[model samples]
Target: MDFEQGSINISDEVLKEIAFRSFLEVLELSADDKDAKKLKKNIEIERTPDDNVIVNVKTVAPYGKSLVEFGKKIMQNISENIQRMTELQVSAVNVSIIDVVEKIEPAEEEE
Candidate 1:
């Protein structure tokens, strides 16, 4: 799933969908991050001259293990999503975690 060229041309619509989907998936994985509890978020994508698509995902994670898990999810989702649109080999999916979300509060339970 490597885009040897470094970047691939995709429709604006596809890009938008990818961004949105990627963001949501990240959000779900980082649900425990208190800082990430903020409903508002954004994701940015850029194509490098070499043909590599750089996905800058801004979100929060529960730290440590959760962070790693979120990263794996990002790669899988992006790779699978791109494949669904076209058979282009994506050189790489670069994900940058911009914000570290605050820890989430545990839910209360009744006896």
Candidate 2:
């Protein structure tokens, strides 16, 4: 169950889970209708010709927030967290906003 050379292989599922968790921590994402494992198809991880890792993420962002900031934060956080946790150099973190989660508030009664 162990390799003599002490080398380890990280699977796509693991990376997806890590990326999902990192995205969730950004506070700008909607937890509803989001699944790291189930949405594995939306996440793609591959090694570039230079051997650097690239991650593609597709998720829903919370409405009313700055989409630009959201993308930047998601990419930054994902890349940093993934590299830190997995020890894999992430060349890029691509985020595709699939939907927006908006909370509609009820209007107050007029006095």
Candidate 3:
């Protein structure tokens, strides 16, 4: 975007962060969760020639979840959040389900 004095720019790292957070939100996961921390490393953002962005995300879906519906949710959430927050166009959001795992419950703490 342009202004009288200068132009505003959003960095790639910022875009990636937005995408990662949106992914976690869709899964109802907290940022401090170990899974979320690992998932953060799997997000990538690429800028197009026209200043738009393409987001690629790799994740493991929880078993028994419908993969198609889950992927659609991730795409929609990431795209909307990025566009709403940065005012930048998202050309595409590509999601790759790398694996599927059963939900693991944390062990009860022993006092």
Candidate 4:
């Protein structure tokens, strides 16, 4: 998708939220920083005057997963969604792995 004349302007925070939510749908992962302030540092959005945006996402993936393929999926998902929603071309989407988290099992109730 593409836009001309710059009729619309979107906030960086909104882009970040879009990215964060998109990532969650693509994979089983968690962001390193849960707080809004810290999250800002993890997700970066660079917007060009031409309506092209570059997104950077840092996250903790589920253990035992392939980082390379995982990152690719994240980038593809974010880029596609952004273009579909805002009609803005995503110049690039970068994914950074901060750490990997183990899946915790729930305890069984007494029978």
Off by over 4 Å in 2: 1-6, 27-40, 103-111
- Across 48-85, the per-residue lDDT of candidate 4 in tens digits comes to 78768999887666678787988899899999998888
lDDT by residue for model 3 over 1-111, one digit each (tens)?
Answer: 898999999999999999989988887878887645766767889999999999998776778989999999999999999999999999999998867778622111100
> What lDDT score goes with residue 62 in model 1?
55
Candidate 3 stretches greater than 4 Å from native: 104-111
Candidate 3 local distance difference test against the native = 0.83
How far in Å is the alpha carbon of 57 misplaced in model 1? 1.7
Which is better, 2 or 3, measured by TM-score?
A: 3
**Which tens-of-lDDT digit does each residue in 60-110 have in candidate 2?**
666888888988998998899888987888999998876767741111100
What shift in Å separates residue 32 of candidate 4 from its native position after superposition? 17
Return the TM-score for each candidate structure: 0.53, 0.69, 0.87, 0.70
Report the number of the highest-TM-score candidate. 3
lDDT of prediction 1: 0.53
Separate clash counts for every candidate = 20, 0, 0, 0
Leading candidate by lDDT: 3
Model 4 bad stretches (over 4 Å): 1-6, 28-41, 104-111
Better of 1 and 4 by lDDT: 4
lDDT of each: 0.53, 0.69, 0.83, 0.70
